[model samples]
Target: MVIVGILSIGFVVLAILLVLVRFVFDLRLTAIQQEADHSQLFRRKINHLRKIEQARHIRYLLIICLMIGIGLAILIGSFLVLMDKQQKLTAQNQIDHERIIYLEKQQKQLMANIPLKKYPEEGIGLEEYEWEKWSEEKKDVNLQRQIESAISKRSAQYFDSFDTKVSLSTPKTISLQLKGYTDDDASREMIKSNLDAFAKEAEKVSQLNNIHVRMITSVSKEKQVVYSVNYSRKKSEDKFNKQNVSEQNLKNSGEKG
Candidate 1:
């Protein structure tokens, strides 16, 4: 840019000098023509000489005009380019500002569509936490279906075949029930252990006001309920977290309810 400015200045200076030279040359030629002998042919010759000089100077003036035009063109072109780049920068800044506003307004919208609950093993736990949060703020918004499905799906992995159902009476309390046919007494213990695992895992991830796990089993193929009992909340919730008082207690009350 400095080079361009220097060249433009040089061109303008040269043009001014050329104009001054033409002015002085015209005056000298005019004086010579007047001082010449007043003969017709000689005066005609002087007039002819004057025409040639004028034409030559006009050509030099055109050359000077060309040089001046080139310099002005470069300066104008540079200004236009600078203005274009500034417009582009302004447009980019506007886009960046809009993105910042969107991020600030909707934080939860990020990664909201990922099937975290179905694909990942810990997805249900995440939903449980979300439920604890969203349940208090909005009405008719809960993740109960996913929670129930997760519990039922996990039951087979931990214990013998048992159909599972879960009910959320409120945001803070939930009930789990498992029913299956089993004659071996060991099967009941396995079911209880698995129930404790499920509840504990849930508690680790979410909040619950009351927790109770129930199981029903029968020895015969008729599927009549022979063992039906409800275990109370964890001792951590009631000064006692034991799932059962003992195996003896489970058996003693197993047939009664």
Candidate 2:
């Protein structure tokens, strides 16, 4: 750019000098021609006038060519500058596109790892995650049918102690609870064994569903148990009851106000 500017200045300076020289030369030649004509030297005056006109024309042509060259140089410089800027913009756009793709992929991985139960909101960012969970649930609908089929196939083996319940918390581990009624050690052992078999079947189904399975054996009071059962169900119910009462009181207070 600096070189182009310098060359442009030089061309302008040169053109100015050529014009000034031509003007001065034409002035001097016309003055000499007039002096010769006044002295009655017609032939010399005519020759001087003709030479001056020819030289003036040649200088005009040179100035026009120099102006054209300067214009072309400026045009070329402007084109180069525009092309450079365009290339930079294109490269930046490509970089931005790749960055966006990387961020989207990372977001997908994060959402996939987040449990549905832990999801905070139903917004654009979570839409794909919600859809995926919904699709998984749809596919898992056949799990019940598959379990029923397996139970029917083994109806004879568990006819005496076949009562069972399944609990599924979304995006969490799946649990299968088997009930035992008898107090006898043999009966408890048989229930445990049956629960294990059912657990294996549940595991197979879980594999298909891409979920974890937990087998839990629950016995009635008549059955002697080694481990104490947690009363969390009663605790949760109490908590819920208290929460509801508080909410009702607040609503009544607001109405009164």
Which numbered prediction scores highest in TM-score against the true structure?
1
In model 2, which regions exceed 4 Å deviation? 31-38, 42-53, 63-67, 101-257
Which prediction has the highest lDDT against the true structure? 1
Q: What residue pairs are clashing in model 2?
A: none
| Each model's Cα RMSD | 23.0, 23.7
Q: Model 2: per-residue lDDT, tens digit, 69-142? A: 88578868877998999999999999999999787556545533532221112211211122233236455545
lDDT string, candidate 1, 111-216, tens digits: 2221112122343342343555534645343566666566666554344434567676565666666555555666566666555555555555444545555555
| Cα lDDT listed for each candidate | 0.59, 0.44
Question: After superposing candidate 1, which stretches have Cα over 4 Å from the reference?
Answer: 1-129, 137-142, 159-161, 222-240, 243-257
Question: Residue 66 of candidate 2: its Cα lDDT?
Answer: 73
User: How many pairs in model 1 have backbone atoms within 3 A of each other, for residues 3 or more apart or on separate chains, i.e. clashes?
Assistant: 2
How many clashes in each structure?
2, 0
TM-score of each: 0.38, 0.33
Ten residues in a row with the worst lDDT in model 1?
111-120
